[model samples]
Target chain A: MSVLAFIDQSEGQVKKGAYEALSYAVKLASQLGTTAEAVVLGKLTDDIAALGKYGVKKIYHVADEQLNHLDAQVFADVIAQVARAAGAKIIVLSNNSDGKAIAPGLSVKLKAGLVSGAVALPDTGNGFTVKKSVFSGKAFAHVAIKTDIKIIALNPNSFSITEAGGGNAEVSAFAAAVNTPKVKVTAVNKVKGDVPLGEAEVVVSGGRGLKGPENWGMIEELAKLLGAATACSRPVADTHWRPHHEHVGQTGLAIAPNLYIAIGISGAIQHLAGVNRSKTIVVINKDPEAPFFKAADYGIVGDAFEVVPGIIEEVKKLKGVA
Target chain B: MKILVCISKSPDTTAKIAFTDNNTKFATDGVQWIINPYDEWYALVKAIEIKEKDPSAVIHLVTVGGADVEPVIRKALALGGDEAIRINADTPDSYYVACQIAETAKQGSYDLVLAGKETIDHNSASIGGMLAELLELPYVSLATKLELNGNTVLITREIEGGEESCEVNTPVVVSCQKGMAEARIPNMRGIMAARTKPLKVVEPVAADSFTGIVSFELPPAKAGVKLIPADNPAELVRVLHEEAKVI
Candidate 1:
């Protein structure tokens, strides 16, 4: 039995989380005393052999042009076929958008036990149990998979990426029957942002305390200075001060960044659920009693108008940017 | 067109989360259950919008749980569903829940299946894809916007950085999230009418769950915040750089 990691890519470029999944699969493979391999669909622009840095010994490339865009059904079918052919006892992938789309379908196709948003490695010592965040990171659950074939989709940033000693993975072209896609892609609109929120190391978010969209200049300036992505609270989005896509909360996007700066936002439990996983939280609010301060690692009890601009100047001074 | 809308009960957004039974089950004493917002506000509301356009469209709400879920189901009916069905099982296993939902959808032969992207409690976000696979139908996930055009449906779903527009024929599954539809509260007339709505209780079909929860854990509590006075905003940046090292 082998462990197979499905690499997710966009526009021929590998996603940041794919490497983490590959590394995870490699570690799991060693735990199971099996070999680790990778499978990549769609044509690629990057060197597939270089993925060996993640410790996978071999990779199966199905360079199909039709597989470029995500068709969850087709992707699941191809991965299932490859997993069956390779005698894969375990399959690993990212729990990002693409992985979420594919893993569930693949589990059904293979009748394998599946765990999504797994935050840690499986406890193989105790019947292959996996720990995952539940209730929007408010809690964690240890789930045991009972099936022989298991699939795990790791939450992005949950596992660190460890590079192997050094070697190129043997890249072999594998052919599988690609089914016609039931979902037809009409258009792809890439939201051009300075930094994608999901991949952003630092995030500066605003709330209703900004007062209006007009006051958002300082928020943007602070985010720009910090090289961070900008986000907003649900009320800001609901009031049309920001786009719904920028909203981060229980009902919105859940992000896990290294540094999260909240300005003018009262930390509600719902909002905290979305972002509690962030490594370091900084809250700037006029109200010292704001619940957000409790969760913040560092808090400034001040007005965003006064505090944000002051912080911006300080950051500029620290970074030596005029 | 027949639309099967899957709804689930979740703790109110502000409800305090705790576990009981050796951390194996969620604590429910004094907790209030409501329809999951994504399911109620987005999935069910959007289905109601479709039915508004075409009165022939039938929206049936389905939930998997014991009698406790019926109240939440009734609220969904009040919003606009024609009826509700309760699968008599209370399991945390998402695969089992998906199996139960698939069985109902198959028997109904619905042309469309809609569900929230994920329930707020477990947040597995897998039912739509799993159900679509089991039914051998197309699946579109995390859809922010959707419109029905004859037999084909136009959808806009959130990707990693941006969004993608796609088209799929009916007999498809979609998991709805924010921006799909506006949330609505049940008015007096709607609430009264909901009382008469058909609520069928069905026994679960034989299905094996491949996963089980062994235990639950709460994340470590955050250390108390380190406060910085308003006058020393620059000090905050200094600490972030030299101490926190985030800047």
Candidate 2:
């Protein structure tokens, strides 16, 4: 009846979301009067035992290089085996790209109830009900999972990461049947030296109001000054002013950063759907009537060319950087 | 090659969201429905593009919903699918919907299955994976690009900080998003031809829904925006540091 968390990693490095998932699983396990354990696939730069500080009692390591790359099927197969071996009644994962790939297939394999995008811990008092975001963060739904074994994909940044001081987990090397992946990897194109937009605490985004792609220098400069990631509206990406990966909206990447600053965006419902989950939103636009202002915590009715440079200078001054 | 593209109906992006029946159901009054943008712009259109490259390719659409979703399916047909299958049922959850689609897809024996990364309404992104598992097919999520070469397909999918290109054979499930293909509008001739395209409405297969919605609630409304003077950008910085502490 122990709870198990999948520790997601890429290229031998643990993802930031893993700690939050581990913490969530640990808390849930305590509520169930059981201990929490974690399963990590592939090799890692970080020590597996050190993760116990996040409250995991045990860590299972499958130290195969093939596990370094993500193949959802292979990952699911291994996870299901580990879950059965560990007698895990609940499986927790971060609802990032990797978790999204694995959870559904794992549910099918285990015949367990599955919920993705879970924003809070399950209410286990009566039945296991999880609160999650639906309609692209426009509303919330409390969903009940009825199966004996339940799977939850916790939304990134939704749960707070808690750590215990100087704790050590017992790490065990586990072996499972590693299947040859059907998906053949040809190439990888990683974003260079920018704060990953999904993990960024502060995101500075621009829209068509930036006038042209050439005007984006200031946006990038401001983002660098603030140690933030840069994002764009759909039109900006559609028009090829920015790459599509940076587009944030309903049909684009939905994000929940701590602070999202929008410049020159009119805040269409499509655009707002992706960003409404941000803890704080700041809008800077020339139009006071822009719908984004209504959704924002702070607003500055001004042109980006003038206003953004001023903000950049002020941020620089505040940070004491040249 | 036979390809199965999954389509879903979503409220138009501009529609106002509200709930009815004690917040247990979405209020459908006066909401205009449209094909989910990701499905229309990426999955369905990419399938159409494949057909354009190879005339021998046949594209079939599948959707799980009642008669209200037929128009959205027809729109997909007009965009170039050869036919569409409608599993007539209310979607209780993603698993049940995936099971229904899997039943139909099993009969079709499609070489490839495609769906939007997720529907705008549910935003679950679980259908493709569940459907793949049910049908015993390889599944890929967030495919940004796909190119078919004989029996193998080259796919580029979005990862955390970048994109990875991989190759997979036919009989696979792929959930598509932006960059897979551009959105297409139905031409008059295409719309006229869509009326003759076969629309098969099959009864849903019996499946258990593991999850049920206990209740729905709206997020708390934001306190109105605090407007700062355009000239005082420094005040914005000061307030962020001292008050919000987010900077």
Candidate 3:
């Protein structure tokens, strides 16, 4: 039995999280003495065969226009069918919005044990136990799935994507009955920005300590220099200093990125709950006793107005810009 | 327009997490539990808004927890839910919790199911999606705004960079987040009314066999903060580059 990975795509291109999931699945497949395969839903223009560079031996392309937009029920149905057809022992998916919507559905349909927010590869020696973050990254829990079929949704940026040379994979069409979804696409409000948070490896977040809405330009400047997405503390959003959409906390968006830079933010437990999964946290604040420093891998105690522009200048210097 | 809001009892937001019995289990000693703040702020509030819009509409609260969690369930009832259901089991895992909630929702025939994007305890935002799958219903997450037009529900969800709007037919599951609605405290009248509200306790149906937790451990304590004087911002940059290596 081989491992099957669900590759998430949007607007005809595969997302970065998809690559991370692919990388993770390949490692898991190796541990299990099997090859990893990928299943891509919807009509994609991207060369599916190129994905083999990520270690998948085969790519199953279900080029259906009906599968273009995500309907969790329909997606789950298609994935469950693909898993059964491939006789997959383990299924891997990225624990992003789409994966979170579909993986659990597929698990229930397949009666498979599922572990979401998996931070590490499974221990496959005696039993299939996976390590995952619990309590919003405050703790870790190792869970052993005692099922024939298992499903894992890897957190974004949790695994490193490695590329190898010259892998030409076979692409096959997965023929399954497509069900018309009850949900209809109304409108997609795309946030116009330099980077999407889920796809961005680096993220820069600010909090109320930035003081007011006018000072946000520096944070944006730094993020643009780094090609990162921007986020804010809940209080920033609460006070209308920033839009609610930018809030990142236990009650807001949960993001896992390679590098998270939190500026002028006192890391409240709620805020940490949302972003603690980030691979590395760099916190900048003038308050030396801020709770965020307790969770940050790197801490800089300084005022935001002074520190932000300095960092921005350094990033520009690194990029050899005037 | 019957809405069922699912709530989970979690540790207070400020609780200091620790392990017990040689780190094999979560230490619960002297820890105070509260209604998951997110659930209270988003899911329950949105449900109350719907109920207010249509006065005849009923909001039901559902949870999978032990007898001790009834106070929290009552607290939800006090918020505005007309009735409540306690699944009489500690939430063992996401799958188990989702299955039990799905079973109850199926029996109740509720038109809508609302939940917080994720429980503050496990932070596994998998339940609403899993429940929708189990019940063969549409699932929408991180919904900031929701409007119902007949049998169709319009939801706007906050994505990574932007938001997406979708229309789903009835019998759908939606996970609520901030900006959906403002949370309200229980007034004296509401609290008194909650005493007479029907709270049914049901045993969970046997869930599909699954994983068991081997152990739990806290993340390593962060190192002491490095103080860089505010006047010399360049020094902070140097520390980030040479010492911290984050820049």
By the TM-score metric, which is better: model 1 or model 3?
1
TM-score of decoy 1: 0.98
Off by over 4 Å in 3: B229-247
Query: Between the candidate structures 2 and 3, which one is better when assessed by DockQ?
Result: 2
Native contacts recovered by candidate 3, as a share?
Answer: 0.70
Model 1 chain B, TM?
Answer: 0.97
- Chain B alone, candidate 2, TM-score of 0.98
Taken over the whole model, the C-alpha lDDT of each candidate is 0.91, 0.91, 0.84
Per-residue lDDT over B1-247 for candidate 3, one digit per residue giving the tens place of the 0 to 100 score: 8888999998887777788888778788888888987789889988888888889888889999889999998988888888999999877678889989989998889899999888776766888988998888888877889898988899998665677789998889998888889867999999999999999999999986576788887777666555555555566556656775645
**CAPRI tier of model 2:** high
Error of 3 at A246 (Å): 1.9
Evaluate residue A257 in candidate 3 and report its C-alpha lDDT on the 0 to 100 scale. Answer: 75
Looking at candidate 2, what is the lDDT of residue B147? 95
**Evaluated with TM-score, which candidate comes out highest?**
2
Ranking by DockQ: 2, 1, 3
The TM-score, computed over Cα atoms with residue i paired to residue i, of candidate 3 is: 0.95
TM-score of chain B of each: 0.97, 0.98, 0.96
